[model samples]
Target: MGRVLLAAVAFAGVAGTGNGLMGQDVPLAADFPEVYRVGGFDAPEWAEFAVPPDVRFDAAGRLYAMEGFLGSGSVVVIDTDGTLVRAVGRPGEGPGEINRPTGFAVWRDGRLAIADMGHRAYQIFGPDGEFERFVRAGSVSDPLGGAGSMGSKLRPDPAGLSLIAQGPPSGVGALTDLFGELLGAEAPGEERVDDRGLERLDLRGEAVSREPILEGWRPSTAGAEPPELSLDDLTEPAGMLTMMMSGQRWFEPGFLWDVLPDGGIAYSDSTAYEIKVTDGAGRAIRRLSRDLHPEPVTRRIREEVRERRLRDLEEGSDLGAGFRAGSGGNEIPAGIREATTEAMRTQIEDREFHDVIPVLTALRATWDGAVWVERVGEEPWVEFGPIDVMRADGEYVGTFAPGATRMPDAFGPDGLVAFVELDELDIPSVVVRRLPVKVR
Candidate 1:
């Protein structure tokens, strides 16, 4: 009775209905539902690449799209009449080789969690394909560390005494974000009832930090007692609800916006230029920013600074020990000092989005709501401006075109949206984005 992957298709059609009061448990869904998209995915040729990382929708609705990474990766089964039936994994890591996979988690009991991210790990494939169990995950790159780094380190500022009075700011931390799309059955009696605990986790043991949030998109209804809010009531436009965690990382440091409505959000905030806004009581209300980027990249330095001046008076001036003078983090070394100002204060006080931003690595989604913004360009080629937006105010609402590969994790049941097409990387295309809002 608990497996309903996605019957949520909403965007601008429900247009009106916010008064609340019917036993008021609040499941009419839309605490902060924003809706926006139309990146449906299109590939007619170009040698074919597909490049999907995550997307889901099984339960008879069928719309799965996984395609590991780079050519022939596979996991693209789409049908509702859309056809393209089989394309499961094969790259080499064992059991069918899918070492690069990155997104898809649909388990209420239906089971389907694939987030491989180049073998960090998470493998379960069955709706018919068989071959389950893999888990692993961790180190989504510097989980949290600064100075020496092993994770959770920082304290190194008081050296010159200009601020050498240290007592509180010890190594700057608090952020522990692991966005696990789902790891195993958490309730209904768990020990390994299997629902996804995948035999009770341990291959990595971070399994997205606790895993709960979707009981009706929980934020504050379960117990209610948290609505102080500040930062502009939490993003105004109406506030509360966000997820912008790496719409893709060419822009880096921005993505994962979920004003905590639990529509399942991940706006990626890597370090920070910040824009949080979590409400359904998840707290953290508003934090847009005085300079969240209107120019010169805000979200904390959008990564793309190349300033050269290596006057090789003659190849290290006749090498000897070669100290070619002129040191600036040694030429474009992924540099951006001040260690991202407290990683933007743990992404607005301990929420910490990640991988910084610039995603849309060539879009994918098709259970029915459509979201394939692979290159809705305007100023992108080296980096900056992959341009993306798939606003799921409820499900398939509105807005999709900014180069979005919208698949932070799960989606697939009724609104179906599972994409992967570039001559079909393994083959997956469920496209059902028929929205205007009918979130029922």
Candidate 2:
């Protein structure tokens, strides 16, 4: 069974230099080791993978992948050697049917806990892929007066399951909400905000306990102040309001976390090169650090990001023409659409950036008690980069260069790793591989 050492360790002292914490620099491997490709698009039709696949491995090394389209999806089970084991669930509202599954987790006993947006509940399936029961999650009213289910993601927990629920709005609120309140609509209750947090839910879906995990980036102005608005702004078009509220600061650091196989939580909450591992009760047990120089956000970098942002907006915007064509009468005026685009451009141009790029970009805990830390690449905008592998007990294994290795979408037992790949035609597939022994 997978286990993480729970012994507390001394916190490493910070370095006087702004570079990073005082620890050994992760040495990069000259090249990635060979891996066996066991599964992919070549699999049977019924076992084919889909876009945005969510995968997990049970204690016995079986891979369970969840994939589907708009209203349909299912979990495909595969053996360690790429053989299809079984398929579970279907698209429907009935028992065992899954509609719009957002996230899922595999229990040590091989049962599945799925977060279904369509059902607004957590559904539990037996080890034999039979639907057992579901727990209806709580809902919260948004500032715009629309209620949405709080559950979005699920994490494995020894006591039960960890539900990453949505929290309340921050920094004034969305422009749409402000407009609704100004128009004399009843405001959202304070109880909704108070209800927000990480909920430990039992199999019955009742909250056994609740606690705050970590905060994420909230919308704010360039000067770190809330946006000022006037009553006159209420008359603005919906497109403008939406665009104004959608802007996010460039390269802002947010919480990156994952649950270890032993129920310990591993997380990186800052821009520093530090990671903390805590037991199920949230007490710190180990702290990992590394020394390195952070890449500065230069003027050229800012300009490049701004250009890319603007280009993306232009490419994505249809000037509301498509909406008008489809919705039949609630069309956004051309002027409003143009103004929205301009507003977005301004937001991107004026967006503030951090002094240095965050030390790590992603964090994942392997089923075998290892944590993979994805470091920022030379180009901050690029998603994939080099990775630093370390054991749960704070032993820094080493680093893999971006070209030398590709981070697996899911890590499994016995040095097994799975990557969800896409073909030229956007056809999705799951490729399973065994990691090199030394790296594992």
Candidate 3:
């Protein structure tokens, strides 16, 4: 049987630092188990502090990871089997280094992209951990694009995309020579263009241009201050929302993943409720929504909304006085079929996600054909869920968690997995976990 832990010696004071560039975010915990799984990690001693932003495996199953001493701002590397390897970058603005490097992804191109939110740009590094170059997204009209979440697919889904949210919205621009000339355009200027085209790189550091890889492409609107809720609803659920906001912000994203060589894309949804698939051209191929649990409270409220709308539409006696057109001049008709349809869409796609978990930190693929996701604390005292295994077609294989933290990156998409721990100041240390299964 599974355990629910809400308090323990090491589970309190769970901390995370955001860019604070987005909307006001809150992280809080409700009820959780007290004694959870903590025996699978290989390095019991080194499993204590906050880890840097990421940890990944190497071709040889060696865990090459980055750890930050939180407030110290030091980034260290570790080898497989839980031994200190090297320390390269530190927290501060300097060349060949980083400032609050919050994200890392080992691309199929063999190079790694570390997102230093303090210093915006996808900083590329060679597999050997050498600083390569930076890829400037310049300004993306939609950073998430048809893509839905920041930690979408196997990485952090980008959410709460609003000019007011992400400071000044970034524009699309090439990371031209930091010291070069341009078409009289500012070094970084805003230009709303279509997909800047796509580049697929492999572990060998080879670059291949491909199309955007999300399907059923629709832009995202998750992180924006949720549209104003009705006063009564807000008054009623205020306590629940307030409590949840303290330890987690469902819309804040921490990482991202692109489809391999624009081949195909598969990823979990915002609420971690479904896995959606898309072709290279960014079209939704399929989706698998989980029925693991049905939430009754949320369902009841939505059902009431539907019933009220139906009563008004059928009888035309009660709600006619309250129908007022919205910004589009579409009046809120008593028989609001349009309103009802939108309401249903919101209930399924957005509103019903009260207890659903958001992508906590990162998502990575195992060397043996499975995906692993790491989150802060799903239940009290529990650091992570198990290494979730699924068939590429979206089958629920299984899950195994050694501790708390995002799914640490694996060097290759093979059998091994890495996990990390962090301290109060937000610095992180690395932990390594592996599968006995042979990764072919």
Candidate 4:
């Protein structure tokens, strides 16, 4: 599977400043103490292993890490004390093999659900790591519309009886049509607005309910109309083509959400520092808010964003390699590639941005029913920033500083949090930490 990295905008920070619903200011914690770490250069047992991007914890507190990213397409099982339990699956299309493991979850009954992109299906395994069955993609009806597959991504609900299936982008067809037209294909049909929703699927990959659990959400976008072009413009297509193409604007308020342990949902739909919690049946239960000031998108910030995008284009660092491989080994004409690059550059230069940066950038729900909302940082190119911890019932926990105190990649039982890290030499590792009692 291919991954696209976006150029993040740099910003300044005002750490530990937020007024919760209780009207009291809560400051950010300086750091989180590490309990233990695995798979680093210093660890001889795991020195050769690469830390996977997807991590989870079962009811038994055993950490499950997918090795699909850099290792064999298997799932690694590790004990809480950093002991290697075993590995399940391998690279292949056989009954017990996984081609490309994208996302996975542990069920309450000890079964493992793995979403395999290469196989285009969900692979199920027994608690003892025994392969059981495969649920092909597109077997279930999409809550948004038509026959929709899970698209190689899913999260186990709090009850572990169903999975939250993430569908494709709402305007993906429009984007497809745009690309088709560029390639001299048929024009796209009318734009669609009903395809923005998430469905609840059972362990068998069947829809639990025909209606979607979440819907009617869309990303914000700002760009000039695409200019007209013809086949004549691509006579010399070749060279590297770099561009920023998406339906979302830079630093804009996008969808931030997570599945709560109680089968509820926590999400932020606007730019404000407010979060809404809905019941398992999709009814609004409560709203959590904090008085955190939004950062203004100044002229300097806009110019900086534009320059960063243009710099990526000039360096051909983001999309050139992906575009080449996506062409199926066929080289795009030099003239067409150059013309497309120029057009993309113009669009990036003329791109408009939100007046102010969104207060929250990411959201995660823990097994204890607490929602961790990551606040935007002040530094440039910072991915994980300070996190605001709060209960699902609107109780304010507090905030933790970025650096070593940011939110964990996966929250486990008994106050355990997992962080996937990389050394200076690019070797991957998984760091386990125990959260403070008050925070956890």
> Model 1, range 1-440, lDDT digits (tens) per residue?
23211113121232122322111212222122222221234532321334333445555665555534443556665555655566666667786567545344443233455545565555666656676665544333432211111110101111110100101111111111111112221122211111110011222243322222211111112221223334443333122221221111223322233211132222223233222332322223333221122223335333222111122212332211212221222431122222322232223332322222333333323233233222223433332233222333312222333323333334445543333332233343323442223321
**Alpha carbon lDDT of residue 289, candidate 1?**
20
Tens digits of per-residue lDDT for model 4 on 1-440? 11111112121222223355443546756455777777877766533455445778887888888865335678888887888888888778898798766678886456788877666567789999999887764323222222223344567776655677655553344433344455455432212222345566665543133335666344444352333333343333311111113344566676677788778877776678877777776566667778776788888888887888799888875445535433335676665556767767866875667778888888888878888898887743466777778877777877676753656788877778898887898677888887766766
Candidate topping TM-score: 4
- Could you tell me the TM-score of candidate 1? 0.22
Model 3 / residue 73 / CA error / Å: 5.4
lDDT of each: 0.31, 0.63, 0.36, 0.64
Model 2, stretches more than 4 Å misplaced?
1-43, 68-71, 139-152, 159-199, 205-247, 315-347
Let me know the TM-score candidate 2 reaches against the reference structure. Answer: 0.75
lDDT, candidate 1, equals: 0.31
What's the candidate order when arranged by decreasing lDDT?
4, 2, 3, 1
lDDT by residue (tens digit), candidate 3, 1-440: 11111111122121122321121222222212221112122335333333244454445544434443232333344444445555445556765566655445543333455545555444566656677765433334323221111110122112211000011111111112111232222432321222212223222222211222222222243443333333233333232232223222223332233342234444443434444444543345554333332223345554554555456555643323223433225655444544444443333333322333343344544555444444434432244543343444454443444342245444343444554444455444444544444221
Candidate 4 clash figure, as a count: 12
